[model samples]
Target: MTDDTVRELIARSNRLGADPRNTNYAGGNTSAEGTGIDPVTGESVELLWVKGSGGDLGTLTEAGLAVLRRDRLRALAEVYPGVDREDEMVAAFDYCLHGRGGAAPSIDTAMHGLVEAAHVDHLHPDSGIALATSADGEKLTEQCFGARVVWVPWRRPGFQLGLNIAAIRRENPEAIGCILGGHGITAWGDSSAECEANSLEIIRTATEFIEANGRPEPFGPAVDRYTALPAEQRRRRAAQLAPVIRGLASTDRRQVGHFDDSDPVLDFLAHAEHPRLATLGTSCPDHFLRTKIRPLVLDTAADAPLDEVVLRLRELHFAYREDYAAYYYRHATPDSPAMRGADPAIVLVPGIGMFSFGRDKQTARVAGEFYLNAIRVMRGAEAISRYTPIDEAEKFRIEYWPLEEAKLARMPEPKPLATRIALIAGAGSGIGRAIAARLAAEGACVVIADRDAEAAARVAGELGSTDVAVPVTVDVTDPATVRAAVDATVLAFGGIDLVVNNAGLSISKPLLDTTEDDWDRQHSVTARGSFLVSREVARAMIAQDFGGDIVYIVSKNAVFAGPSNLAHSAAKADQAHQVRLLATELGTYGIRVNGVNPDGVVRGSGLPAGGWRAQRAAVYGVEEQDLGAFYSQRTLLKRQVLPDHVADAVFVLTAGALSRTTGLHVPVDSGVAAAFLR
Candidate 1:
């Protein structure tokens, strides 16, 4: 394919995947094929460009699209033993790579290649899946769109499905698309635009049929009444259940669950037929790998006390695991591996919204997205008639398939702090950004909250992994914004495990020169902001019944006096005292509170940028070039401090290096006698 053609194909894939109604995150694939010069052969040949297995279509790039020799990929189907050839097929695809660049093509590459079209789009649109996965899916499909689309029965995706699609095309040469029973839809055309239009046309046909001929009338009151409840009430219920769910979902392997909940979740969970709909298994067979067959449904009401709620949830988790074990034993084949413990990927609670579980924040969020899309599709199916999807036997087959497991096995091992979520205030720059980066590197997913939205986004983008960081704009001093940030953290990462109170400001003026506004502004951020974040996060951690860490970034001025720094010094002193008091009070709940006090950092610290160090240097009558030496001479170590030095102390305390210690101040200064802790 020409460079322009490749770019257009990738752009079309991104556009199709961008709509959640059309495709869930990482749930679909696309391909484009044409004649191109082979890198190795140096001759013209047919090349098939397909989306890689793990890449997200919405963010598809030229590099993410794997290029393969079309003849080589198709030739593997001829000699391969038809049964369980997934591994061999994958090897053949990898073997045909044009060059050393690009990842392995998606497992569905064979199916795309057999279509004989210039461009092909395979998407799991909710509307199409809703109609196709139903009990009478084939009948309904024919009734809705006559002969324009063909219906293919459930077949495991591999060489067999590719052959099946080819046979269908041979019989129905005029059909524009094929809807895979209990899976998704596939469309092909001479160009990317034509393929896009054909897929949309099929979805529109199904949607119209469901609305006109299948829309349910006078929905029942039991679930309908709950869905009608106030939105705030639903959100509050979800928040209350979030920490308990996280605690119950945690495993002995030290995996912590992340949660996503909202009004849509509440409505789905509270629906009259929710119990039946939620347990009927996934709307599509491919989802069996991510969501399993069914979700765990809890019946606890929102009015229950925290202690009682925790006890009940523990009982439910135990029962769910036992049942899962029984199911595994009943269906185990001789080839089955050692049985893994039952961990629910999705949790549905009455009154509260549904919560999804994963080994890390991004995984949980992705699972949540899939389930939410499932709910939307299932709702459409139910509106038409009872939503009957694939049976349990087929679900188990896909769940244990080695081909699907290989995708997960290819991933590298996680970091020591993997799956742990941390919230860092003022992380847009300076010491705060350093701390955030260090934590993310250690495997903890960091929430970059800052007053500057653009800076936070830039820092988040700079991080190497999409799963490691999320940026949120937050003014720590505002109570509403502070509370929203706390909720965002819980929703994004299940519950808070670490909090870095790093946001601070200063007014470098003497007592008489400092105005009332200066004092309030300094205290608002340094003292009051710390209190709010500490209190809110502590409440969430305590609810989770899991121990947490909170570290305050205090200044050396909080311990020793500095003239012309009255407002900042007083505010820092207040928070330093507050940390000790909070440590004493929250220790009973297993929450550790500590502080890190740094003297001076000549570069890349908030002190220099905000002119606090310059003002002190001016008081000493020292030039800018001599500031580092002036501060270094005051310490015994005779070396200037850096932001990274402060960040190291923070990690030591927060990352369990000081698990049994709390309420003490760690000094990051080279060594200042006047600022030394007593």
Candidate 2:
């Protein structure tokens, strides 16, 4: 191709973002100038232009391009000491470009100078990087490009990497491109179009490899591993992470994803104690910029020193920072800014993949998405062969570079949910208690109201000085009690933020055996109580100028009417419709309303006097023991429901976790309701 054609290709490449996923900012570099043997002289021309470190590829200009003498760079590398290698390399290039007037040469100048081709393009493209860092990376590479590509294991970038590539090219002169294991790739061609085409081909081939092998295994069989872990162990682990996460977040309140100890995958991850297993790092180099190089391994058996773990993690962070400082001093010129202090971009707990933290939500979200994608690619690479990671020093240099650190710092501030408040009724026990606990865990100050004063106090005691939870007693069916509850909650917590209208009643009786008095009693608590409490809470919330979330704990009977539950079914059906009206009327005020319809919560606190055993015996007119076999055989899962199951549904609704859901009833009956609907 002609020089004009190559220049056009360079401009097009510069216009493209580093990561298509990261359109807001660019993360790569490029150059158009070429270097070769000058026809007039026996020596090579100082015609190479490399992109300066920190310049965005997406909007690169002539000023961003760094012109350098390829011959001078090679000479300096050969004579410099190992520790002074980067320094001498930079100095030599600076001297060569003295009066040329362009940006400083990129840190990768030494490596790029060694390439024998006329045009070379390098990128940390997500697709190719994902494959390169995966387990069977070499095999995956061969499958993609056949004999056109060469795979080189990870080595420190700059001198060692350049030397390795040179040796590989010498050994395989026919190779069109090179894949750096656990890093990125280099595509060289006779023309810029050919080189860019080769790069695109490599990415497409790697993407296909991932498409064929990267999906997570079906969760059915894997769930057993997560489910096997003890609940207490899971709780403790979550609790320990909570305070640390809160501190990292710099917020007193934050909601965390569910901690499912019963998940087979989680259980397996928790028990993975083998030393060999513990050494696994992230799948890609960019992941290190989020989750750090190593994970925080927890030894649950012995008295694991949490303080020691934190101290060690901090030490590792500082060490990473110091190494980054050394790397900058070695590679950067005096004009370059000082390296940022090394705080981990991501943290990995032994069992957890990685945790990305930022000052705000958007930063955390971007980091998290990148980290997860890297994990998937890493796992896919592992499927092909044992995947390794980039060297610690190299990653430290990239992660702590002043330019990258500035990118993270420049991220926009997070949106605030600070004015929101949540109130959980019937929170002294069962699902109410669980919802209250979850909302409080997420940083919401919760006022827990229950008929039983002692139960409210007990729950309040458990939560302690976090003051995120306050307890009060109220009779939901009484207007005075409902108003007083709202007044007290608003007074203490500032305003009514969210109202979990979960206080209700249930009674099971054959249709013909049902009494008018029994029906009235059930309606009083279920329908009337909901209306009373909701009306008062809504008025208070509207006056406070802050809209709210209201969730009613209805029943599956509202949809598939249950046998021998005429009164309870009728009451719940009415409550479900009431929630919809509230949603319609409150939408303008920014209030949300939803419902959870649970079938039979076996171990729930509100279960009738005889429990499931008695209820089944009564239904079939048989002894309790005989009813067990009948119930177990009839149900799909054969396991009774736990209070926590229903509580989880309420928590998700009241915590404002589901953004699009409102005036909708979510069934928490584990397919029972599905079967009935079908």
Candidate 3:
């Protein structure tokens, strides 16, 4: 019946972690006691494999587990320098490593190892924490599960806390687990399946108790005026405020943002006691870590004129940062991790929505999710009894814990374009797709914009989830759709920092054969499209006051005077000059404008094959497949240009390396001497 292996441990962890009903993301740790062969001694040594620092149990893998000799881990209890020096003990776990290259041990590692059972789970299930943090938590514990689960008082997580849980088990022989005061729940059993079952039982029983016996309207009745706005109104309002909020958040370090307006959130915000509860702040350490001490709750009404509301929100933002700094100064020890930031991570605006900020998109999104968990905990606690969380001092102790800081220090360095938001037009295919993929690889959150909705969605899906890329349908010729695309980008992320004007079409015709309609059609999609999208995105960037980049995918035909390409040549020429003009005009704002000219990119792009391949091939007296060869032969290097080649040039122009060189056109045409920008 007992399985002393990490495989079962990881399976149990993933099952508990994957369900939002069980625990928040990366908010719990699971462990198993097993015997493994020591590499040097060739002896079976008892080992404790636990979830590693800064990793999610749902995504747990063998490499993500910290393997330590159980005896060595337990030995630390003898020399434990008490609660005051518990942070020092985190360093001691490194010495207990059973093998090389396992993940770094987390602060909760000792708790898992010190427990008497072979399998243990430490989770932040909202239902369990609700009872754990209620005003009369110990009394409620007796009422709900009675002798099955014991109650342990609030103790900051470390060596001492681990000792406290172990002591509870000794005192309460009938208890399956204990609820840590103002924290989460811990469960244990002889096997992984038993441990998992016990943990779920606690969560399920608590949920049922809350539903059957708790009072109605735990948050009090909803305030009519504070209820959620209509769907369209909500999205529109969020889009308008996102830029202003993003600008404020980017003050110390540029942050990407996520907005949530789910029913649970709206229900909480509409309640009478929302402000009081939020002001008390999040109780769980994991909650405050992501949400900060509390949110910046906006008092402005949803129906108020937006411009005036923005001003009020800005004032609140300034006050929030000031109050945050005061909170830091109140409890910060000299060694406390130098005030991670003073800006509010969670912003609450009643009737509108919640806006969460972080160093990147996924982080921002996760922060919002954690706050939702906090909301759930609060609701349950209020239903059963008076809701209470850990005091602010305790929150500060865990927030600035040295062990947590060290874990942060071990994270991989960010990619070059981290925090930059990009909107790439024509991203559905060809050079645009290449540019989108390249930018995403460098850590940019991209917005895929194209006339073809399905194509744009396909490309966006390939890039990644909404955190990495979002698709927006846009007809470059239509001013309305162009502006909407910019708004969609702001709504999806916070704002725009990079714009690629790659949406274009080509039509090749001799002077006598070319029609007026052909000339107008090509120019409308290419020249006008670029101008409209750039104007809207530039407005957003200017409002953010953050310098940005705009790159146009021009063609070598603009300079080379290629045959049978009159309309295409004229449009590209117009686009090439516009880049220079915009660069000079927008230079004061530090918005860099540049162009990348490529010679007949006939391989991957739909543009080449869309309609002009055969015409251009006939013009050069070559077959459709041989057209690329003909274009390459004319170049000095006789090298065919690829979509990725043009993509590289676009990246070089915008990726900060060429910051000082604006209005400069970079050529990706395999050494086209005549096509060089003069």
- The best candidate by lDDT is 3
Q: Write the per-residue lDDT of candidate 2 for residues 1-678, one digit (tens) a residue.
A: 225643664575664454453222334444444544444465557566666765666667666767766566566656756743444455466765624536766556656667776566666666667667756678778877788888988764556566667677667878877788877777777666776677677767776766676544311133222233244544444434432432332222332211222233243343433223324555444555655554333333322466665555546545655654565566665644565433444444443323444433334444555555554444445444445566555665565555455555755553333334567778888778777666666556677799999989888777654235668899998998887787666444334567887887677787787788989988998899999988987776565444568889887788775567788888988998998898899988777888887765645455444654576478777776565455444567666556677767866775556876788788776657343533
How high is the CA lDDT of each candidate model?
Answer: 0.80, 0.61, 0.89
Model 3 off-target regions past 4 Å?
A: 1-4, 608-610
Please report the TM-score between candidate 2 and the true structure: 0.44
lDDT of 2: 0.61
Q: After superposition, how far is residue 447 of candidate 2 from its true place, in Å?
A: 26
Residue 539, candidate 3: Cα error in Å is 2.7
TM-score of predicted structure 3: 0.96
User: Per-residue lDDT tens digits of candidate 1, residues 74-120?
Assistant: 78767778766555776677777767637677778888877777888
Instruction: Write down the TM-score for model 1.
Output: 0.86
Backbone Cα, N, C clashes tallied per candidate: 1, 27, 0
The residue-by-residue lDDT of candidate 3 on 124-159, one tens digit each, is 999998998899999998899999999999988888
lDDT accuracy of residue 528 in candidate 2: 94
Task: Mark the regions of model 2 whose C-alpha exceeds 4 Å error after superposition.
Answer: 1-10, 14-28, 35-46, 74-87, 98-101, 134-140, 210-221, 224-246, 249-279, 283-286, 295-344, 347-355, 358-366, 390-678
Q: Estimate each model's TM-score.
A: 0.86, 0.44, 0.96
